[model samples]
Target: MSANANTTTLWRPTGPVELDLVRALDRRAWPPRLPDQPIFYPVLNEDYAIRIARDWNVKHSGAGFVTRFEVDTAFLARYPVRQVGGETILELWVPAQELDEFNAHIVGRIEVVHEFR
Candidate 1:
């Protein structure tokens, strides 16, 4: 894969995150691996991103946020894209230690698409 593959492919985080965490990720364009979280999830579509951030995340915590960004498709290829319920919703499960490398694969700034509180 090309070194710049991250520039062309898009990624979005899946799951509800705190407002502060969302803002922090936007500032850095990548997220640090949380302790014991084991997997870093990035979804394949806006619909899923919205669903998780709005429905699941907010329902669980009273706050949720979505961020869109680009990642190296090549690096992403190393991990499997999983389907939790059906084909419409898909996500990549990145290992924790590898999350840093995954962060490196990020191409640009992460922007918030939706926020709920």
Candidate 2:
């Protein structure tokens, strides 16, 4: 589906367990973060998502997936884009306690765009 002007696309690099939880949610929402996970970070670019999925998730979980989704641009404006590395390595850090609200802003189903094992 085409994203409207009010929407912004985001990508997430996830491990198999997280992917399964997403699937369980029927792709409509992300599950609550684990106790140790304080933030839910969705990346700003597909390439960076791919790198993390392949390099980190795969190494740690034996499988990795890149999921793409769109969220309301206005709602996302509250979180500043955080650049953890290079210019392209950008993401929005949504507080774990706010994930349900974040999920409410998602524009469409989260889709698995790439996978590595």
Best by lDDT, which number?
2
lDDT of 2 by residue, 34-91 (tens): 9999999999999999999999999999999999999999999999999999989999
What are the per-model numbers of colliding residue pairs? 2, 0
Error of 2 at 59 (Å): 0.5
> What is the lDDT, from 0 to 100, of the residue 94 in candidate 2?
97
Give the top-scoring candidate (TM-score): 2
1-117: candidate 1 lDDT, tens digit per residue: 123634544446444443466566664545566686787777777788887777777777777777777776676778787998887788888887787787777776677777766
Model 1 lDDT, residue 97, Cα: 79
TM-score of each: 0.78, 0.97
